[model samples]
Every structure is written in C-alpha cells, then in structure tokens.
Target: MADHRAQDKLAFLLSLVPYLVDHDRVSVAEVAAHFGVPQSQIRDAVRLIGVSGIPGETAQYQHGDLFDINWDDFELNDQIVLTNRVAIDDSPRFSAREAAALIAGLQYLSALPEHADRAAVASLMAKLSRGASAVPSSLTVEATATDGTLALIRESVSTGVQIEFCYRSAQGEAQSRRVDPLRIESFDADWYLRGWDHLRQGVRTFRLDRISEPVITTEPITFRAQDVTLPETLFEGSPEDLLVTIDVVPSAAPLLADYIPAGAVTTEIGGLFRTTIRVSHYHGLKRLLASMSGMATVVEPAEARTAVAEWAAAGAARYR
Candidate 1:
C-alpha cells in the first residue's frame, strides 16, 4: 500500500516538472487550485525542479538552472516563465537483479490473503515494470502451516471459539495465554491474530510467526459484533508506533512516501525532500534503514541515534 501511494506521488511530482518547464513563471495560486494541492506544495514542487536535471546540462538543457524558477515575487507576480527549455522525459532504468526483485516482491504482495485480487495485482505489477522487459520466468512463495494453527485460528474467529496458545513475544520471551479470537490481520509481511485476552483482559495482537505451540481451546467463546478495543491502540507499543524521518532522493522517495502520512512530508526551501514515517518495530526500522543506505538519512527520535551509532560501529568493525 505504501509503495503504491509513493509511486503515485512521484508520478504526480514528475508530471508537474514538464508543465513547469513548459510554462515558466506559472501562477502559484492557479497551479495549486488546478491541482487541488496547497500553494506551499506547489512552491515546493518548483523548488524541486531547481535541483533535478536530466544529466549534464548542455545547450539542449542547462544543468542546474534548466527551470529558472523565481518564487521571490511568487505571491504578487504569480507568473513563472521558463528561461531555459528543460526537456523532461522519462528514461526508465533498472538492473536485471532489481527488475527480478520487483517482480518477485509484487508476486508476494499479490499472493497475500488480503490481496486476493490477483488479476488487479498482476495488471498493476506489469504497469510498474513496464521499462524492464525481462520478466521472471517462474516465481513461487511458500508458507508452512504451524500444525493447523492458521486454519484453527480462522475457524475459531468465525465460530467464536476461545483459544489457548504458547507464543513468543517480540522480545523473544515465552508466554502462554487464552484469548477470544476477534479478527485476523496481515501487516508488514506477517499475519497477526487480534483477540481479547482472558488473563490480561485487554486486546492483544499475537504474531503468527511467534506461535510456538498449536492453538487449542475446549471452551466456546462469544464473538462480539462491536469492536471491544481500538485498532490504532492495539499497535501502540509495537515498533510501528516509532516515528522516523529521513531525507531521500527523488528516485527513492516514491518507495518511502506512501509509508508516511499525507501532508507530513515536505521539501526544504533549498529543494531537499524528506519523509516522516511511523515504524512498528526496531527490527523493521533497521531493515528499512539499511536498505536505503546512501539515499536515506535518519532525522528524528534521538533514541534511534544510539541504534545508528551501533550500526555504524558494527560496519566500521567489519571493515577494520
């Protein structure tokens, strides 16, 4: 979902660059009103044009000032004229490995239970990988059932059957609990069982991966039609609650943008773009942070500072 939204925003922004270059000194208010975006957002979009360029700026397209945008008199004089003819064209580039990975990832996302619309997913995946002609010949993902735990959980939730299971917490601590199954969910590449715990007397999310023993229940449970607990609060203590910010390149922004809330991301006056995201856990954040190595930079939560330092130290040690 995040990936889809980010790509949409990138397409929107990239689409605007051509328009801006074509009609220089465009009316800020007019552009915003036309696009249904805030005036500030349009200004940011103009700033983005200043830094983005096709390659070496030559006679065809000037390097830096290809789109000579002047927002100084932007408010009163809402007209922006293109001093240089900036040729904005989409040159799609992808490595064989990257192309293959994208195909594999799309397949995994499409195969999830929540994303049962395989046809729609396939269409979208094809659209995303249009530039990459090389298609993966065969892709298959597998998940071994935990002694009918998943089947039992689904039936138990529908049938209002109480269940007991031994599970491991995120911290790898062992726990045994009885819960009245409510709803099952898949998030961030894992399935979760959201239910009302008998002992804790509160809502809990049990990770399907951490279920050590088989789920079994002798007693019948009553499933309430009304929600007993807030869905937002259920993930409060999880890593998804951790807020993170990073400055990313435009190319990478399409991947990270949707993870952040709309209107939360903004470009600096100088044209550097940044995104803020609320991650669910430390491990997930670590993985995400590691993947975007050079393009991503951590910007908030001083606590993450320690983790960054530790990671850097580890890398340094490896090199040494």
Candidate 2:
C-alpha cells in the first residue's frame, strides 16, 4: 500500500507539472477536478514543490536552486501560477532496468480502459524508451489469469467447438455469446478472441479480460480459421458505429490515440485539437468523454453532447 501510494504521488506530480506548464494560470479547484484529487492534496503538493529543489555547488540552497510560485495568488485566490521553475528540462533519466519495469507495467495498463488518471500511460511508454539512458530489456504483463484464458481459447480452437461466455463490452453492457473460436490474437498485453458470433450472426472480437464463465460447447465450429479470412487490422468500424467529433485540450491530446484510427488526421483551432472517434452509441461516447476529465468537448453531433450533459447533470444531482 505504501509503495502504491508513493507511485501514485510520483505519477501525479509528473502529470501536474506538464498540465500547469500548458495552462500557466489555473485554479486549484480546476486542477483538483482535472486530476480527481482533493484540494488539500493539491495545496500540499504545491507547498512541497515550492520548498524542494537541488542544491548548488555550495552544497546548499541558492537563489536559482529552488522552485517558486505565486504565494499570494495561491493563498488568496487558490490559483496555481508557477513563477519560476528549476531543473525543468533535466528529467531523471531512467536506467535500462527501470525503463523495462515501467514499460512492462504500462503494457499492463494498456489492457485497461483509458481514464483520466491513466490516459497518458500509453504515451509515456514511448517516451520512456526514447529517454532511457540505456536500452530497455524485454517486457511483458505478468498476469496469471491470462494462462487460464489462453488455455480455454486454445482448447476451443483446437477442437473446433463453440465457446460460450458472458462478454462485458466497453460501454459496461454484459451479454452472453456463443462463438466458433477461430483465432486467438494479441495486441500488446491484451488478448482478443476473434470468432464467428452465433448471437450476432457475424464475426466478433472479445477481450479476454472482459470474458467470464467461458465454457466450450459440444457443437462443432461453424467457422474455422481456414474458413474465414481475418482482417489485417484488429478493429473495423461498423455501420452501427457513431462518429463523434470532440475538441481536446493540447496537453491531453495523447489520450485520444486509442480512439483515432490509422491515417486519421486532427484539426487544430484556437489551440484545441479536434478529432473524430467511432463509438457504438451515445452512451459509449459519454463514457469516453467522462474518462478524459475536463480536457475534451463534444464539438459535433448535438445528441452526443446532450447525452453527456444529462449524464453529468444526473451525477451532480446525486450529490445534492
């Protein structure tokens, strides 16, 4: 628990500085809401940062050695306005082992939903590789459950039988599915089962983590690997998919990588980036927007914004 707490604090500090650098002048409440932390914690962090810095050649604190902040604005208006920064460009370069460990953990996070806190994990993985002092070692997610999931998928694929399971989609909907297991594929640390779905009467992909109570049916497979041609790409937008245009703040732009397809372009206007992403429904779009903190806005499809507004209002009403 202590280790986790320390890691969380480190992550928060790393993200907070970049966000502050981007905005320059932002309220404490806004920063707290953006990072989903308490105002007190943010205040404590700012205070700690004000006093912490590297020592000069004198082996003691010097004028330019420490960070400085607008103390009056912070105390009087509860605003974060950094006045001076020290060692801002000098990040601690990670060792080969350190880089490998962080890359492995980030690969694990890639399997989970991209939320406000973890949105930058995928992007940070690449930065680590480039910024590391030495070559990073081999890395992989050490998930024990993956072993059992792979075993069941392999059994169904080898026997050419149908696999039945409860699948939980990204939008939080759970449904039963019977699929003729065709192939087991992987992207990063995430494992996906692509097969012929009897329920939908089409080919579907299932994330192994979202699958539960999986059982192999005696029924022979209707679509074997040889019978079906799998797409070169993992995800193909369907007719049911809704294209949503959203405006994301510059600092939070990396969070949209998972949503933007290959060769897709983003439009920048007034310092905010506009991008389109495909979602199954308005509810899914709302969920995605909620995960982005306050960094994203629905720029098109009035209904999508309405859905998100209603969701937010309902959530706020609960507090009252």
Candidate 3:
C-alpha cells in the first residue's frame, strides 16, 4: 500500500512537470485543487520543482522568485495558470531493447484483425522502423479469435465447465475434444488454451488457429482447485531430433533459417550452406523446398529424404 501511494505520488509529480514546462508558470493553490492534494503538499511540490530542471538548461534557469512561484497569484478558485515556463520536449527515447520490444509488439499486433487500433499500430511501426538506429527485422504478424470466445473460455475455466471445440491438429486433421480449460495464455507469438483433455486425461495446449469451431458443453466438469500446468515439452510428436542435413543455396540459407528452429539451424561449412533439422511432418518442408525452385536439398533425416524421393518419383511418373 505504501509502495502504491509512493508510485501514485511520483506519477502525479511527473505529470505536473510537463504541464509546468508547457505553460511556464502555474498557481500553487490552483495546482493543489486540480490534483486534489492539500495546499501544503502543493507547496512541497513547488519546492521540489526547484531541484528538477531540464538537462543542459541549468545555466539559463535557476532557483529564485523567478522560480517565480506564487501561491496567491490565482483568484483562490483552485485554477492553476502556467506562464513563462520553458518547454522541454523530452519524450522517452527507446533503447535497443525497448525498440526490439516495440517491434515484437507491433508484429504481434499485425497478426491480429485490423481494428481502429491497427491503424495506430501501423503508424507507430512506420515511425519506429524509419528511426536512425532501428533494427532490420519485422514483427508484423496477426491472427483473429472467435468473437466472445475469450470471455467464454475465461468463464468456463473459472466455473469448471466442459468446452468442446473443433480442433485442427498440426497435421491438418480435424477432431472434436471435450476439455476442461485450465488456463489460456500467449506463447511463441501465438495464443494457446491449455486444459485437461478429459477424454485423454492429460493436459493439452490448443492453438488458436487450429480451433475452427468452438462449442461449449452444458455438463459441468470437475474443477481442480490447483492450476493445471501446461506441458513443458512440446513438438514431441516428432520421433526425436532426426539429424537432417539439407544443402541450401548460399543465398537461400538465410531465408530458410527463418522457417526452421534456431537450435536446428542452417550452418555454413566450407563453401556449402547446410540445414540440419528434425521435423514431425515433411509436407510443409517439401512444399517450401518446391517453392524455393530446387535451391534446397534434403541430405539426411532419411525420412525426409524418402518422402522427397517419393515426391520426385511421382513428378517423374506424371511427366512420363
């Protein structure tokens, strides 16, 4: 509570400094009434302002009656008038970390639907992206969820009601599951609903994209007072990390690096660019390779090589 009060006081003080800088002079009694603080507190705030000056403006501005502060200048009507103050346009300058966070947030926003906020997001991204020290990376991806689905999920989870949704697995297989939603959270730049699979009797994370149709069940599921934790290990559907070696064109390695996991990365050994990855499904990778216009090859991960072989054979047979 004490911390909260101090934070509130700091925030109020910070807000006042900007107004003072904008207007040059402010009445003490009016300032107090405006902020709903006591007259004594306002006096203390005025005294505190003497110690706070814009950086590099100390030689010109000094503490004096020219601090020119007067408590009785107003009509005692609690209206503070600022006059003869210097304007310091010291808005926050983003550091590299702050800039990266902003870019990531914008990318996350881009993945969502185009709302009124989307225009603001686009404008902000354009402004930041053109900054002198801006990074050469994109954080623009967006996705949309079912209307009112979020509220329904929250209510169902809190009340321990069963939720049935038509979920499309990563393999593009669609099925329905009656789940007791434990928690819904964002991860890896996407939203996930983690819950107990009453049918499977285990925890599962449902990707927002994969959930095509949601149907809430009337049956009340037994709620565990304790929170159900999401699975620590994911992408285990793949049978272990199969060491896949793919030879990619020197120019394409960088582009391919974006699609594969950081750990399973493209490496340059000697003159050749190679990608070593473990994949559960080969279809997506195959399609990506086809789109690359024969710039990439699957050297290892015998499973991927076999799939590619079959794909090639089918193409050859079609031509014949």
lDDT of each: 0.65, 0.79, 0.62
- Superposed on all Cα atoms, model 2 deviates from the true structure by an RMSD in Å of 21.3
Query: Can you write out model 1's per-residue Cα lDDT over 31-58, one digit (the tens) per residue?
Result: 8887888988887766766665554535
Model 3 RMSD, rounded to 1 decimal = 10.4
Give per-residue CA lDDT, model 2, range 207-280, as digits (tens): 88899998888998888767888887666677778888889998988866766766667989989998888777
In candidate 3, how many Å is residue 24 off? Answer: 19
Top model number, lDDT: 2
lDDT of 3: 0.62
After best superposition, candidate 1 residue 155: deviation in angstroms? 4.3
How well is each residue in 1-320 modelled by candidate 3, as lDDT tens digits? 99998898788878877655444345666677677888888767666654555434465545432333444554354334433233343345466566667877876544332221455766676556433143545443333554355556655654557888888876789888888776556644467767778877887778766776677788897644266544554433434433567888797776654345556655676667876755556775566567776777888768888988898788889987
- Clashes in predicted model 1: 14
| Overall local distance difference test of candidate 1 | 0.65
TM-score for each model: 0.43, 0.45, 0.43
lDDT of 2 at 304: 86
